[model samples]
Target: MTVTPRTALTIAGSDSGGGAGVQADLRTFFANGVHGLVALTAVTVQNSLGVQGFSEIPVDVVTAQIKAVAEDMGVDAAKTGMLATAEIIQSVAKTLDEVHIGRTTDTPFVVDPVAASMTGHALLREEALEAIRTELFPRATLITPNLDEVRLLTGVSVTDAASQRTAAEALLEFGSQWVLVKGGHLCDTADCVDLLTDGSAIIELSGPRIDTENTHGGGDTMASAITSSLAKGADVPTAVAEAKRFIERCVMEAYPLGAGVGPVSPFWRLANPR
Candidate 1:
């Protein structure tokens, strides 16, 4: 059989820590057998400990990168994370709109609304939230938001599976085709649970929560892993299911790498497969 490798792209930031953002997405893509590509939107001086400083890529430069990638290398599926400003969000949203208008019809646009850090520090500008929800989110094939980002977008503080359901519906009305509400941030339980909804059906994925603090890039990892599956022709529900399994395995084998919280191992499948 003559076949080309599946390709996926990520429009996000650079993590100097080599754990989250661009680094994490590319790593997850490669591990999942998808060729990875990127259009960086920002640079962050960060370590496993925290982000010390950050700089947004100019809107023109960000626009150029996305155009360059899509024009040539092309994308079968794509995801976005950590757009630091409103301008960057608008640019990414518009570019993807154009990409879908032509050859990439079934390509899934996975948006990971990374509004805040695990420690409650804001990673995105407050002004950018409106751009993400209004400009980019409605165009998304699947929107993955952790509980914190869900509250920021929906104003519904999700504390359990029941509240998670409410938050998903509120997000749906905003126009995304599907919503995957990651419940990793919920403090009420020892088991990690995530909810995926597409108006009519609600799918719940649960696993015994591995006790670990090295989970900094969990949201980005989850979204990109799903994008990788979509690039390889998995349906939305199947992609979500496989990505959930991937993230859980990554967490299971995750080791502490730096002085502070480490990141989940996106390439954990090499050592252990489920």
Candidate 2:
């Protein structure tokens, strides 16, 4: 029998390398049994070596793409990545508000807060930081930030669990319903521990730290998995826990691509036949 899959939208840039950004998010949505939709914000000239150059889409065009999908197909959940500028961030925030598809609305909204490429090339402009914190954070249902992004957003360098909580609390002050402080960069630990909180209760989700350099798309994969779970009707905490499990497996199955880092493989699901 034919089935109608639940829909999730990604408002982000395109990764020409097929590793991260919209490419990774769409692949994740499909892997998790959700229909994927897009509102492309920018296009990057990148590879495993790094991001070389990029161009942002017009703000009006970005706004229109979001309106088109959210109006006609409907978005059960949505996420943002690599907005590229303060202009795009402000416009995307306004568009999300207009469509009623954010924290203030019933639909779940995820803010990945992408600031740089894995190879240390800046993806978000330096000036866009304030706009993202002030405009997008308040409207986010959940904000998933890697340790580096946490430091960039809140100026809190997370070296351990104590500091991780402090950073998550700081992000909560921005009005997001939940904050996930990803601890994959906490190199001191044997396990990759992510802290989830809503300003009161706290949950620690841990996974074995797979020893691999092919982790290029790891962040995008986890965030997209959460978006996919949210689209499939899971609650925030449940969605996040499920995403943690999904990403750990993807990381373990990661394979090398180019001379530099490679992407987390979602194709493992196909091989395992789950």
Candidate 3:
């Protein structure tokens, strides 16, 4: 007569402002009806204005945290964000293999490929970029990259539909099972169009672009929503579609917080009553 709640893990940094990173992921997980777990990679001193300073958790500590939660609680799905260095990324990939939580395994693992803060402060080191391509991407069930991250990862500037397709293909070459080239940063379009592909089947998630500067944590919210849906037994396409809808509503409900930029509110779920 006991029902077990679905669970998802976020192997990410901590946002002191509580609008992004594991904070946003946890909120998104809760909103999507899943238990959330975390393996914090770094701690950032940041606010609505921007990131000021940060500290990366030691690689061993990072891996150990992942191992502890994944082995004990059992992760149905997991996602990574703001991995600060090449050493950490490599160690994380190795630990993921040890824990059997990767694309090659049964569990879905999302790679957010976070390189910098939304305000353009670097969250990851320059050297870690290559490690993400060589190590983590290959282990990913899906890679969700904003237009800026797409350019940083693939050196392909995604401007329109054609470029989005190109960027997705480029990401696929790194061996991820699927790629989501997020077009939220593409201002030319009336609707914010995100291109999802697996080197063949292409699906476009298009929604009315909500005009708001308070889009902090937008990407993390979408990624965690996908992970949460995956934990609830949804397929990748279904999970992403549901996440797209979830995030669009979150953006629509976003409210101004600090002086600079506010966060996209996940509280929309409460008002909408699930």
Model 2 residue 27 lDDT score: 84
TM for every model, in the order presented, reads: 0.95, 0.98, 0.98
On the 0 to 100 scale, the lDDT of residue 67 in model 1 is: 78
User: For model 3, how does the per-residue alpha-carbon lDDT over 128-155 read when each residue is reduced to its tens digit?
Assistant: 9999999999999999999888998889
Badly placed stretches (over 4 Å) of model 3 are: none
Model 2, global lDDT? 0.93
| Better model by TM-score: candidate 1 vs candidate 3 | 3
lDDT of 2 by residue, 1-274 (tens): 9988999999999999898999999888888889999999999999889999999999999999999999999999999989999999999999999999898798999999999997999999999999989999999999999999999988999999999999999999988999999999999899999999998879999989999989988899999999999998899999999999999888998888888889998877777867
* Candidate 3 similarity to native, TM-score: 0.98
Query: What is the overall TM-score of model 2 with all chains considered together?
Result: 0.98
lDDT of 1: 0.86
Model 1 C-alpha lDDT per residue in residues 1-274, reported as the tens digit of each score: 9777889989899989888899999989988988998889889889877888789989888878877878888788888898999988887778787777212367778889888667565679989999988987788889999887888898999987889999999999988889999988886698889999999999998988888888978888999999999999898899999999899988877779889888899877766554
Error of 3 at 128 (Å): 0.2
Instruction: Kindly give the stretch of ten consecutive residues in candidate 2 with the minimal lDDT sum.
Output: 265-274
Steric collisions counted per model? 0, 0, 0
lDDT of each: 0.86, 0.93, 0.93
